[model samples]
Target: MLEIITNNRKKATLKYVRAFLFFSLILLILFMLFITGVVIYAKSKGAPPLAVPQSTLIYASDDSLIGETHYGEKRYWVPLDEISPAVVEATLSIEDRGFYSHHGFDYKRIVGAILADIKARAKVQGASTITQQYARNLFLTHDKTWHRKITEALYTVRLELNYTKEEILEGYLNTIYYGHGAYGIEAAANYYFGKHAKDLTISEAALLAGIPKGPTHYSPKVNEDGAKNRQQLILSAMVENDYLTKPELETISSQELNYTFGSTKERPVIAPYFQDEVKRLLASKLKLDQETINTSGLRVFTTLDPELQSIAEEQITQTIAKDSEIQVGFIAMDQHTGQVKAMVGGRDYTESPFNRVTQAERQPGSTFKPFLYYAALEKGFTPSTLMRSEVTAFTFDDGRERYVPHNFNNYYANDKITLAQAIALSDNVYAVKTHIFLGQDVLVNTAKKLGITSQLASVPSLALGTSTVKVQDMATAYSTIANGGVKQEPLLIEKVLNHKGEVIYESTPVKKQVLKPEEAFVTTHLLTGIFDEKLNNYTRVTGRTVMDQLTRHYAGKTGTTRTDSWMIGYSPQLVSAVWTGYDRDKTIDLTAEKTYAKEIWASFMEKAHEDLPVLPFRAPEGVVAVQVDPDSGLLATKKCSEKARLTYYVKGTEPTESCIGKAEITNEEAPKEADEEEKKGWFKRIWDWF
Candidate 1:
């Protein structure tokens, strides 16, 4: 009986063991299937692009914020190489000690957290590893719910499967949210220390590492003691992880740190007009896509000089009346490189989004005469070339139509005058005679060669700037003349960098020889005649209003029309263009409106050159500067001391007149107007331009 009972008990025990082992196998299979399904679902979802999109950032030449394109906000992404190694050690020690060993989820940590939760009878401890926390920060909200936890588990698995450990860490470091609208490690570093992440010391890195746990409560800006305590905790953890010694932690904790206190504040849009131009050029010049310009996180290092921009704006504000409806378009450029340093599109950007500099096309008025004069110079016309300045009508198209041009205020010399005298007086009749003599198409072609892109009609009025041109194009055209006949396309952006800090584009200075160097210098010299009162004939030279205030020599022209007033000028180092007029072609009847351009140009040039060394317009090779009588264009002598002026000419095109007194502006001795060909004869006379 005892043996039978022993056998039955043995059988019972064996049966119970078999049942337990079978149940364990079934449970393992179910668990495996559940994990497989979770992975399949995660794969179906894939990863919604890991990077948060940001718009391109624009910076001035000095690396300050000029403006941004679209919706980028303040977050900055830096590679792991740029991040401080101490930040990594501190974060790993405190946030996830088993980060490297864990695949995605930490089961051991989960079990421990569960035991702790049961002990407190409340859900308190978290089992998130670095990977899990990254997944949650990127994709989900931090709420205590089983549904959220399951979703987080799927994301963490996806991150681990898709990216490597280093990549995951980089993404986490870049995308994690810190306090006070600081989003990434780079931005946080800039905000707190006014420095880059790569420059952070171990102590600074520890302080930053502590912020993510409780951003508001432990932010040094908000709670100094809390931030200090949290930093100490992270440093102690670093010691435990063998990343640092206890003594090192104590020393770091005691070290004093300086905070920047001022950084990443709300930036006002600077050079709004220039920013618009950068966008347009980025598309047209570089072939950058509109979408990329808006969201590629490009770091556009532009050529904007903030000090000059401020001066330009101030000049406009001070010159134009506060209540005036006149609009202004201005641009300042480096003559040598064509880098646009400053620009103001309108008086108020908010009131008018239209960019007058690049968008508006208006008549150039007398400013157009420079091209005509330059063309004449190339055709063997000298500064002493004689032109009869008087009211004259010319017949063209078989004498079917007559076009007569008039000077400002209908003033004229009504006698034989030199080219320099005609330019100084802005004599319209002489300009028309020269325009007619040059076959009407010469001035148009010359303007195009100088970089004017706007359409120009090859008509007699084209010599007078009747056809419209953009201000930027006008500046570029003059830059060619200012740089001694070399064309330089405008440069708004010096270099462009993509989100990964890879150079995408760089400026190469579009330079090409266009005008004859000697002839160009003569033309540039003629521009100064507008400011020289000694060249004054029937009327004051156009720029004489600001002549006394000008401390240095400048090559410039002033254009006046029924609607538009223009001032475009250049020094050896800088070129500036200013346009002021009504937006809708209303006649600019106000004297203030007409003088606004000149005043602004004068003020801007003087203040902009405050710290710059005085640079003279050096004469190029094959060019000769001669002191001549302003009215006769003859070589200067002691007898013509007060009236003599320095003039530039092509080596062979200079005047051969002896040191003799020329005819003065007197109604008594003035000669009658000469015929068309005779009016433009090459001889001794004066030249002046408005």
Candidate 2:
């Protein structure tokens, strides 16, 4: 019996030991799994967030950042070293008092919070240390679940093991959302104080730090009163933790903050549509993916001049207001470099974003006359070439019917006019006659060579701007003339650099010789006469009187197409184009004024060139100036009326002989005053009086 009892005791002891070993193995496996999860979760965190790209915020040469066109969100990541130390202290004192002493997870605080929750029969508070909160923000969502809590703790431990304390703290401060479309301290500083995080005051820093606790609930945007209350609570916490003395806390709390609750106003709208164009071009031509172009944190240096952009904006706005029906678009470029210096896509970006300067395709109207004359010039037709400006019709086979173009006045003169005279007066009959002389195909070819990329027809009416083209393209075409016949493609962004300051793309202007130097010179000379002599004779207007105050010498053209208005021209220094029409092709109310384009052009040119030196068109090296009859397009004689004709000369290409009696040098004299008085009867006199 004694031996049997001893055997039973030994068997029981063995069984207990076996049970202990199995339980120990299970615990060991669970710990290993937990550690593995922590490692994996830490590696799965999203990247440290960045601010909107610099390209979206274009800056002028003077370092003034232009129009803001940001998407996604505005966040400026700042390192802990860059933040004010007071902000860090204030945040820790309020959000996590034991941040410095605790590890990633604080066991004592967790136990206390749990006990409090049990007593209240509900969860009352959180025990997230600063590092734990940052870990959650970086890796986890705002989920109230045991699994998420466990994951948060694991991520916190992993972060503590891998990163320094300062790095974690910086990550926390920068990754926290502050409501109001702001996602970080830097963004909060900009939104609330209109300044950088580094430049924030102690009060401002404390206020921002108070927000991440409950951004929307305590947001300055939503609950200004709650935000102030939370700010005071932070101040109290700071005092208790010795971050701020009681007296200092009292002083700060009592002071009025005067904070503005919105985005920063430091950046202004210099060029709205231009910036849009830059972004599109960068994404398309450079083959940069959207993420890299918009979020890779690049700095795009553009060719916009804030001064010039401002001038263009002011001109369009003022002109549109004066004539409410006219909505204007303009582009001004440097003739030498093809750099688009200034542009106004519309009167106001917010009012309309059509961006006529780059997108809208309106009829060129008479502004296209230059290209027609250019075609004639290339076909052995000098400015002196004569055409019969009489009414004529042409029939073409377009599967429908023939089209006959007409002059604006709907009347035709059967008399012969020089090519220069035809262009100056903008006579449609003369232009169509010339187009017929040089077949439509040849004219289209010449226009294409002059930088017109718009599709053209083989029909005669195409010479009248039937081919659609953008204002930018038209500006490019005029630039060729201003550049002495070399077409330089317009460029906005000069270069783009990546986040690491490596250049991703650079613009090298493409120069295509479009016209001979002589052809361009002759074009310029003839267009100048339009504004100076013949148009003046017809309306007693002259270039000197149109913008008589301008000290700089320039040549330009004004055009209007029923509902559309345009003014495209060039000086030796700059080439510019301006258009005005309604958003939905509404008719512009020009009243009775004939020179609708001329008004805006004169105002803009005056203001634009106010600070620029008065510079004249630089004649080429071999060019020479000689007096010629602008009316008859020949060498001037004394019989040519000084009022009826003027002089412009091209280098190495002057008239060989004087035009003694080339053609009528003056307008057909109107009926004599005595004859009109005699012809008027009693009824006519009564109608005149009435």
Q: What is the TM-score of each candidate against the true structure?
A: 0.84, 0.76
| Residues 239-267 of candidate 1: C-alpha lDDT, one tens digit per residue | 99999998887889899988874455445
Q: What are the C-alpha RMSDs, in order, of all predicted structures?
A: 5.1, 9.2
TM-score of 2: 0.76
lDDT of each: 0.85, 0.72
lDDT tens digits, residue span 1-690, model 2: 999999998999989888888888888898899778766766676333323242234556566667443465665556677788878887888878877777677788899999999999998977889888887777778888999988777777777767777877887877788887776687788788887788877677788888888887987778888988988888888889888899998899887786777645654566878887888888888887776666555667889988888877776666555646566778989988899988778776888877888888887777777887776666666666656666667666653665667765565556666666666667777777667667778877877777777787767777677666788988888888888889888888888766445777888888888777766777786777556555332222224336564556677766667777667777777788877676676766555333545666777777777777777666665455665665455676776646345444444445676764535433433345557777899976642321
Per-residue error (Å), model 1, residue 105: 3.3
Candidate 2: residue 138 Cα off by (Å): 3.8
Model 1, global lDDT: 0.85
Model 2 pairs whose backbones collide: 623-651, 624-651
Best by TM-score: 1
* True-structure RMSD for candidate 1: 5.1
